[model samples]
Target: MRREGSKAFYIHTFGCQMNQADSAIITSLLQREGYHPAENENDAGIILLNTCAVRENAVDRIEHYLQHLQGMKKRDKGLIVGVAGCVPQFQREEMFTMSPAIDFLAGPDTYRTLPLVIEQARAGIRLASLEFNAAETYEGIDPVREGLISAVVPVMRGCNNMCAFCVVPFTRGRERSHPFKSVIVEVQKLVASGYREITLIGQNVNSYSDPEDGHNFADLLDAVSSEAPMARIRFTTSHPKDISEALVRTIAERRNICNHIHLPVQSGSSRMLDLMNRGHTIEEYREKIALIRSVIPGVALSTDIIAGFCGEQEEDHQATLELLSAVRFDSAFMFFYSERPGTLAARTLEDDIPEAVKKRRLQEIIDLQNSISDKHYQDTVGTVVEVLAESESRRSSEQLMGRTDTNRVVVFEREHYQAGDRLNVLISSATSATLIGRPEHGVVQH
Candidate 1:
């Protein structure tokens, strides 16, 4: 059903891949209801903010945006403003009190009900936020928009692991996997719609389990790969402890599965891991890495690292450096730990790490990782690799940028190529974060 005079809308998304996928679903739903996507906020009748609650900085930014929106709403009286995703899930009533400009507030799981909520809000009714549901799945709604080659499909929602420093468990609630048939159906549709790559997203993707048929994440991956052999398969944010041997084997067997894994090891010290409630030791993490490498030769490894947690000592910092050197991740997302309200760490541990010390340690990790990343790229020089052309290079129009199967960014000079085209490139040069290459003679079939 389409509204006769529905106006254009725009959604500004923040946070992880899950949030991005959620925004896509929202976009699809809005489009189905006759809302056209606007080019910018200034041109839209409705403005939606899909926010993040991962850090306090994110909250501050949202508040600043809300104040700006208040002024926008005052100028345009018919503007419909809404807040969705994790932030609204946590600060429901508080957000309404903070910004009277927000006409609608919807939680992560409540997106399916957004059309009804927005309709009520447009009728000049005060809208209340809906609580998050663990079992909610937006599987049947077709996403109206997607990236050129890569698309994110959220296979599950929320988190079961209560890592002490994280508010995810409290904000998102217990984990629940989406039905396997639904996931496969979505993947097939995406592949048929010209999508080449799919990354299965969740809080802890590897922990996904379908209770109906007793199928786990590995089984799900196999099913998807078998059904959609034309598309590249990948998944993210794997917990170190849950990465099974079968998962590694599946990657090795599948020709279209990407050769990259992002397993987060927040800390290196065993004591720190225990304090963080990570449920895996440093040795266990190393063994998992070794197993992954053994199964998929030359696979690129990446990780998330946090510097200066509550009680991190000099020795603990040294151990972290040692672990980095040993693992030699091709890339890392590094951050200085920030305590969040309602988290176990905030309540139990003292955030005693000096800011200067934390910054210094983070820099050290960055430098080391930079060197490691450079080495990893340098090793690939003179090798021919396949890349999926994404877009033109930021620096020069003459160059095109894409990513290899290992997920390393490659910039090359190529003509007569489009965004979704796959090409083989002969590597000529390497840097810390990029590979310089030229188009080779052949194309690799998917």
Candidate 2:
């Protein structure tokens, strides 16, 4: 039977993978309340923007999108428009003033109240809530995982670190880990449902420790991987300071754990690291990188880099560039330092670097990383790697696309192969962004 709904909703999401996971839970919440998803905003009875406030421009972008929604509301006076996630998680009152079109608001921790908020909004009551639940990790909520082949399971919520430039501590509240058994149960269900991949997500995944049993991050990872040995296990957003050798060894030893880690080195200069309170030094990060390489010889390394941070000098930018060249990271997510309201950087330091300087530094970082990535991709040619077939290649129907354990996109000939099939493919050629390959042995397992 239908979970809910002749009524429909449209969840427009922004920000990180964590936000994507949150949006999924919100979908489940609305579905359980008897609402279905609309094909688009025009068809939906409600429009909710799962927002981000990591950068000032992200908020600007959401506000700009809200302007268009005003016309949608004009067509249906009863249409509910709401804002959720980190953008309003800490600034709910400001959000109410930012856009008159919004009829309601919610925070990262207050999604359980969404149905009631909607009901009240429809009755001519505009309300907003940002109640932080000490234990809310949306555990009881069964999320719509979007598909069966891969699922995102949030094992923890919030962060304890108050990085000088970050708003996460303020927006997401204090660090709290989810119950270990609940996480294990969730992963077991996904595997039973034919999920071949599970990505354990969190604000700081390495910091996760079970609330009841006192199991640490590595313990949880071991449990999940043991439960589903054939499934590709992956995790995200590891802070450098918390990355343990045990975690690195687990990735090396576990047959299922994908050998890719997202270690964010916001800046390579120790001076900047101290200012950001990232809790690690450049030399220490380099040592960790060395340890990771020693353990997982072929690990694909990715990272996040911020350019022109507060009080950044030309030398600091040079230092970042030098690290990019030295590490030769396979890929990176690069951004210009944008002061978020309520963050330490905004309250105390200057966004002292000129906008032009930030842009220049960011572009230089991108160009360097791309060249390095090209070099790395070229070196992988002729290697036989196993990739889990995912979808029809966007370029052609005759080609199938999937990702290597290192997380590189590999496109291969589609010869009776189907999605979820793992195939051994030999790299034939490379583009700047993708690797083209041919299947070594067709249809190994689907």
Candidate 3:
């Protein structure tokens, strides 16, 4: 496993929590093969950028970064540069042509072969491992996690629902859930190792079903909760159509499950929903939201909204605004539609919306979300919330930063507290993005 130069490796990850988890797994796999982590890119013999292709800008950023890396490769002739994850998967052989600095390409399901690929690259070989493995869940591999307080454990990989504007289904391949027992074991290990919070993540998490016994996502959640009762549990990127009543009740019943649901309603217009092939109508999404609210009162709600989709009119944009106002989401991840190549939208639909119109519509969505989020935070100013102290505040070392069960960021004075300490904090002030608090009752037990 030893190379000629620095055996230190560095991975720059882009995109979602899933990609972060994938990077951790990649680190673990490489570390097992005697590859140590580099403190930074400059010190590494191998540098892999785990990229995202959700938006055109993300791909542009990666391309720009690769251009910068070209100079570094020239400086160190033995430097192994590779691109992994979505971008490499989507781009395939074109990546090598696009970025001459890149020596190899590894897709989302291709990390197991990285050691061999790197070795080949060192021997003057350029290659790609982009084959999709429907059965590859990396079950036995332990990810070399970076953080101490919270970690993301991917419950499943890929997406089955091909929303026309989405690139996930094509990039990550078909849906496959990790073994039920394996996930529980991972959670137990994390809890035993003193990690306080775990997020079970997937592209479409609500559709996860164990291949062994056909146990659904709710069953998996309940099992994880029971396995690690002390650790807070969270899951993300739920498809609105797949969120069942059983799942809602499971969240309501479980004491450890955090009271937050990130249901992505891509567009508010039913016509737009149909165009995207989202598989759910606007009314159905609303009903699901209402059911969730009714079951878990005060549940912090978040969503993803795409503005200016194919054939979007002013009326459709207005409908989206109306939905935002009606739902009043605590937070939102909003973006203008970017037509991903090889997707249904790119193939069939016309990307007719003008760039200026898309930007304007996206700005309106942002403005509305900010107002709603501000109101939500303002309303919580007088209440006390349990905060899991994650790390020192970015602004000041004297303050500790954490998050509420509802997934709101909270910052409080650090009075002999450490990263994993859970504390009850009295909300003193608020911003749209953060809650400033004072420790109410010192450290909370469980």
lDDT of 2 by residue, 99-142 (tens): 78898999999999999999888888898888888789888888
Model 1 score (lDDT): 0.87
Candidate 3 runs further than 4 Å off: 1-5
Q: Which ten residues in a row have the lowest lDDT in candidate 3?
A: 1-10
Residue 366, candidate 1: alpha-carbon lDDT = 91
Best candidate according to TM-score: 3
Which runs of model 1 end up more than 4 angstroms from their true locations?
Answer: 1-6
Q: Count the backbone clashes (under 3 Å) in each candidate.
A: 0, 2, 0
In the range 134-156, model 3's lDDT, one tens digit per residue, is: 98899899999997779899999
TM-score per candidate, in order? 0.96, 0.96, 0.98
Question: Comparing 1 and 3 by TM-score, which wins?
Answer: 3
Could you tell me how far off, in angstroms, the CA of residue 8 lies in candidate 3 after the best superposition? 1.5
Candidates in order have lDDT scores of: 0.87, 0.88, 0.93
Q: Best candidate per lDDT, number?
A: 3
